[model samples]
Target: MKRNLSSFAHPVCATLAVGALAVLSGCSSSAPLFLSDGRATTLVQCPVGSDSCSQQASASCGGAYDVVRQSSASGTLSLIYACRAK
Candidate 1:
């Protein structure tokens, strides 16, 4: 006799999907990355159609900053940068 397995599949798959999403969300650029020398790289997010992200990065660094990487997704722009030392 074959046991009915459909009843258990949906909940298990849903639980696993949610757990995976939670783990992946931590990988987003919202978190800051610190260098070995104590210099920290910040992530600045703004609307994709504006210069706000770059301006924000400059403000965060208090002067100038180097862009480590940048990407735009879902109408949001993400900029990862490290401030230049004075």
Candidate 2:
């Protein structure tokens, strides 16, 4: 007796396609990495004595987070931050 295989092919193909899409999407950098407490954080450095330093740092924090700390050393200013969600 010969067994038919076409009936199972579509589901297998669809499953593979979905699995591939999930894997590909997981590799994207657009997604933010959040901490266990649901906050996202990053470090930003800028040149001291520049008015744009704070602006650039805020932009680097994705424009939603607040500047938690600001420090300067040598000629650079550093910003530590966490995102503020609505």
TM-scores, each model vs. reference = 0.58, 0.46
TM-score of 2: 0.46
Backbone clashes in model 1, listed as residue pairs = none
Q: State each model's C-alpha RMSD to the native.
A: 5.5, 7.6
The sequence of per-residue lDDT tens digits that candidate 2 reaches over residues 39-85 is: 87666787888866567655665566676678999999887677677
Over 1-86, each residue of candidate 1 has an lDDT whose tens digit, in order, gives 77579988999999999999999998886646887666788887999999998888888888898888899999999988999888
Using lDDT as the measure, the top candidate is: 1
Task: Candidate 2: list runs displaced more than 4 Å.
Answer: 1-37, 60-64
lDDT of 1 at 73: 94
The deviation in Å at residue 5 for candidate 2 is 58
Sliding window of 10 residues with minimal summed lDDT for model 1:
29-38
- What is the TM-score (0 to 1) of candidate 1? 0.58
